[model samples]
Target: MTRTARSRALGSRPARSRTARQHAVGLAALLLLVAAAPASASATPSPASSPARHLEGTLPSGAAYMIDTPDHWNGTVLLFSHGYRPEGSPNPAVNAPDEPTKQLLLKEGYALVGSSYATTGWSVEQAVPDQLAALDAFTKEVGAARRTLAWGQSLGGLITTTIAERYPGRIDGSLSMCGLVHGGVANWNSTLDATFALRTLLAPGAGDADVRLTGFKDAADAAASAKRLGETLGTAQNSADGRARIALAAALHAIPGWNDPRTPRPAPDDYPAQQANQYTAVRGLVAQPGFAWRAEAERRAGGNMSWNTGVDYSAMLARSSQYKEVKALYKSAGLSLRDDLRALARAPRVSAEPRAVRYMADHAAPSGRLDKPQLTIHTTGDALVPVRTESAYRQAVAEAGRSPLLRQAYTENAGHCTFSPGEQLAAVHTIDHRLTSGSWGDTSPSALNSRAQQADPTTEARYTTFRPGPYPRPFRGQGLFG
Candidate 1:
């Protein structure tokens, strides 16, 4: 008999202190590099700049928010949306990414404000509204700015884009970093492709076919499921065929072999080191945070919102960034790549409940009908939220006839939300320039790098001109992108 995927019963959120930012939302999922740290110790405020006026409060919806306005206001206010908060992490109602970045922006005369969404786990439903409410509150507190710009990291990046699409008149322009820009349905569904590959090729015993993929009864249920997958991944690492299969699974999600932001990227041909890194990288991702993300999304969307009914595994491998790696590894292990994909083809497929897909599309997905100008940036080697998100969003935007409104850039770095203070400031300045000049200036990698180094010499800014491949599993199904 097949074990059930998830219990229909809803789960309770883990109690957490309102403190440090949760890694799930941040998606720098692992490896925090001190070298990437910005806000240099030697830097001092400009003589013309003064400390910001700080204000904090709770919205009527119960979301806490904070605002900071410099003494010399620039007639601009940046509305920040934070990443998704895991169910049971220490979440602080924060607006800015770091104290230094905040100070640098304020010192440069820009005001900033952000809200801790009404509730934590998978806050997309309330995140945009909470942010809009915070914007209203900010306007009431200090009068309306000349213009408002929206910006966010990770899930907040999705929220930032949603605001532009749904309520553009409220803001002039926006920026999204390391965002799940493809939409919620695509997120879950594509991830299902990756996890499905893992289970089919590497599951110990009966495999994760028995594991709960969604509608988790609670965080523990999701976590326990994640644990099983992690253990499977661990055991698979010790064998040649297992490593090859791991490469295939990682490729499905565009999981990079390079894991840390602080460390230099692995040489392109170093397949062994890369595969080993992928093993470690994917292990952390399959943990509680990853499954819990799906669980919370399911809880919000009303059911299993992801499926893999007709995804072409062969085509998916063809489009993967790590396609060559998978092939090379398979040959090294004397495994037939064709055989495994055929097995995946024969494996039982998962289907989504119609209601969940509809709910997720309306609230959590990007329609690509961009109303305001958008500047998106991503780290090239981002493990959790791959750079392909930008690629897919660009396709969606081009299809929507809104390509002119979006400008995408990439960092020659790894990890999620790992931008330095200078790089972060550079994005703000770039978007601000567009909003002001009514034209996107030279946004080339070299130009951005120059701008970042000029802003914060202490931080590194390695921008690159890159074109990401096709999104492996887009939600071309009805009720979304239709």
Candidate 2:
């Protein structure tokens, strides 16, 4: 996502045939929306329970999407925009919300809508407008009032925040989860950190050695260093350094040789899991001379470089003033920052949907409001989004005197949506409270906590069983990235 011009984000799913009961539940929800509408309703959008309607269309860019509408939409609408996919693909409208979210929204009479935002090739600027357009189309067709709620996950989160800032009164509430708020700053910083790590792996005992790639004139020297780096990777992976090992594997996977240049990598292939295991396996054999077998294998196979990694890294590194001072970090990591920087500048600019960009551009502060209440949630330990981004944004908003309109929730020991039932229910309740009352509730334990503490194990098990599966369609070839 960082490498891609338009930043998108997140994971995958499993398939189970829909059940009769499920269909019944959906139908029931739809009927309620239609029946609940006010007879005298005029242009003002009001909440109603209607069966969700799916709409599809082509955007100006020729990008297409399928959007799902949860029926009986209370004019209070929720729109989710997905983050960037390295493949530059768009997401289906219903990308990230869980089953619980759908049920809760439907039962609450909230209309939930999502779309793939036309072409994935467009950046957030284009995608955000497309979403707005989609909403316009939906309003005309459904006759729902214009009062709305906008939200997105990762890249979608980025889009939502920008919209919230830009659109002001147009949006009632905004939620962005694990989005890249700092743009070039965050991307460049992370890349420098990665390069630094790589350098450390290469020069184990020589930790004091500078990571100057210029010193190495040819493939032989670079390959030798790469071999050393591989051994370090092996050691780290095998030494019970869980996070470090995961980080290394993730960085490697991000590079060209490890991943498929085409097509979004699905979640189920467990690419990260596989990469970790592969590193572990190779690490076990590093004591054997010529232990950098994998790195050597890659070189022998022509080491086809990925276009995104180096190019994006260079673009960010150049744009970021901080990266300039941190150049030594790369030098210590044994990488040629100068060469990569030049090469990336000359590379083509990646394209992305304009909707997200427009949303961000519109909502930027000094020009936006600070009166509406907003709640942001992000897993503290998220490797992908890097929790720092969330914290930084909150700080920025607070510093801007918008603290009254902003609040943040941190999920513990969770991945993207991998929260415990207590966490999920607590979040749902919080959102409901904010939407219904326009106020973040006073500090108090939630119903979910009480239930978790005293409820019967059988009931608890049943509730847990209903939890949404990880990445709804992981390998089904149906994601924004795919």
Candidate 3:
């Protein structure tokens, strides 16, 4: 079972009232540190007298990163961390000290140091140290500020928050965008995803290795299954190596029988066949048969696949090995089919054995109670990192009576980093206000995600008339990003 983009889903806006205004003001006050940045530091030589040079290096663990220094830089510095991908050469496009943030900060007189943490297959324990080391190296090499600000997006956000918590005094403040704060289940929404992948692969539409391999136990039968797979996957959808996809599909099929080798559960109701068709179709189009999947398939065929080898290797050898291997792994991980699927929803948590968890918990505190100012901006219709996540954290902070330091801004239309110029400007304004005034005070409902708001007529009609179809131009009312 797979999900398609829902045609009708409403966006939720922040509660409108004077209190929202007060929250905005509070955020402004918290970030006021940036406003007074110039006054606190001593006068420095001009950047013209000195040109900032970019430096690159690798950590002891082989994680690579880079740092840059502006001429005659003041003490202020910012450390940049990217999400997911391994850090290598700096990509100035998205990296800070790149175009946008760099130009703004430089004009305002702040030194910037960008870094790439240890890349994929490496956890934050390795990454954070590499980042800190980069900062130290930048300071000594370029002669900049003793303290620095940490910033990241998505996975980068998680690392940024963890770094902020772990090195409180050493870090000035953290700027996290769409970061994952809640660990375990919240971080890994994959169990259901795995189930869906299995279902799609096994469905009657096309090549299904699981079914091909199931009946045959002998080597001849295994060879037959592989031959059948080669024939079925020759189509564009299943073509290329797609080893991970194959592994995921195989895991889904094998997991069910491992727990109840005899009994089988029915498919889920939510993933209607039409939705599944749409998902497979769209995904097939978007992730064409060449790059990531093809390479994965080639790697698997070569007996050298990375990124969750457990799932891949097991699937590749499913016909040869007994079911015991997968069963043992799942049982150890508490993912037996005998349990309710919802119970399996709790992902690999901190309590899960250390060997199984990916990233190390740098600072595992119950959410910290911060006295400093903080502003959180999120799109109500975020498809990638749902806005509900931010709301949960805000609610937790409120329940703990530590809401004083928090300011929240909700945009109706944006999703993840997707935002219209108007929405982006608003976000920039919010950040600017926080940095300048040390407080924020704006909390009026604004049309951001038009599609999302249109899902609810009452909300949509209140703002403006709703016309549905491909997004109409110069989009106005209830939507920000097209």
Candidate 4:
């Protein structure tokens, strides 16, 4: 079925609950004030029909973990790493994407495990060790598995990859779904580029002197800045020139033209519609208040972790897949591309503090040294975590001389982490097949789609053959963020 029809069937998404925000605040306060002490595992009896052993406990670092072992004992454990949660957000009891997927894996005889992490909000450094502690705790309490797979979503994707790279002997394979594998430096700098362009082209007289780009002291300040920028973009979208400018900014980062999952992908030449969709993504999702993970990242790293110094917009434009659309929009709007490029060149650029850069490099950026088979999946129209991340990651893997060990898949759908149960299962099965057979199987789109259909008829159709455009603002080398 078409995306529009599916969207109509699903209807509009609900707003975030106030209770959730409140819980986050409470959790954040508790974590900051209290010191964590080592704790032992607590075992719970499983259902009679399931016959699985469930264990829960806290680590010395104060992170909580959950483990499920089926009675059949498949000798394989799947370590699940969850996506980023804002500081103060309530910790999850289990990190699986969906309960159905969890149950299916358990029934299939795979053990499930995940940790809450030591502290929240851009805590990859803490997570790496904390997750290791969880694994060690699992081994100590439940005995070692014959094989283990590192599986994570979003930021957890990065963690999963890091585990495989840093401790290859501990993991047999890895799967990263909708992950920011491109690293913190490139991802957040790309975000800064979009926000900077918005402020410069649309709200030139804000008078805060680029404070919107870097002066976030807290969530409230970040929210206020995001609100102002969002309102400006909304007003600018009314004019042809304004829309063209938005396209240029989005193209700079290879932002997708699909934002609303309820809508279908725009036709290639539909610049106005495309820009409109991108504007909704930037303003509503990327620039939203709760979406301000950068502030926390900066605070943790001791200063700004992103920089756009020495960037050449012309060169970036030349590399972007959206260049054709951008050129078309500019020409139709009677605007000069040269003039926009000049404006970007003349704008004040942001730079990162050295210590902050080092922190991110040590804690977040992936070395791309793959020691085992790894698979990645992304939606073609993802806005929050952009499909360009997949492209950036592919480049990193290639540069590390591990291209043979990496495989990527794509879906035609929009939104972040929007995979269906069937799609998720198909990915897991693909990795499992490789591990079990000691050779990669038929991972073609048609084959995966067929597998998904068999598992769940309601699964969204797959677009595994889709190749994402190049990441326009990729980090070139270690010098920038290392």
Best candidate (score: TM-score): 1
User: Backbone clashes in each candidate structure, one number apiece?
Assistant: 3, 56, 23, 2
Off by over 4 Å in 3: 1-51, 59-61, 69-75, 86-94, 97-101, 190-372, 379-382, 395-401, 410-416, 419-437, 441-482
Candidate 2 ranges beyond 4 A from true positions: 1-52, 88-91, 182-184, 200-232, 235-371, 420-429, 443-482
Q: Which residue runs of candidate 4 sit more than 4 Å off their true CA positions?
A: 1-50, 205-210, 289-291, 474-477
Candidates in order have lDDT scores of 0.82, 0.46, 0.41, 0.78
lDDT-wise, the better of 1 and 3 is 1
C-alpha positional error of residue 71 in candidate 1 after TM-score superposition, expressed in Å: 1.7
Which lDDT tens digits does candidate 1 get at residues 1-482? 01112224579977765454474545564435544557684553342243346778888888888888887888888999999777766665687888888888888889889989988888888888889999998877667677899999998998998999999999999999889898777777777777788888887344444676656787778888888887888888999999999899889878887867766678999999899878877787787445877887788888888888776889888978798899999999999999999998888878888888888877887878888889999998887788888888898899999999999999888788899999999999999999889999899999898889888889888888898887766644464331
Worst 10 residues of 2 by lDDT: 473-482
Which one is best on lDDT? 1
Give a tens-digit lDDT track for model 4, residues 36-73: 53433433222223336777888888888888877676
Model 3: per-residue Cα lDDT over 1-482, one tens digit each: 11122133589986779988999898899779666776534555434454556566655655555655555555557676665542233432123623544555454445665555544422454566777777766656566564466766555666666676567666756666555544222332222233234333433333324422122233344444444444444342342223233333333322211121122322333222212232232233223221222222222223211122113222333331223333443344454333322222322211222222322222221253543444455443333444445544565457657686665555434235443333323333444445457665553334323322333223221112221111111101111111
TM-scores of the candidates are: 0.87, 0.53, 0.48, 0.85
Q: 185-226 in candidate 2: lDDT tens per residue?
A: 233233334434444343433431333221233345544554
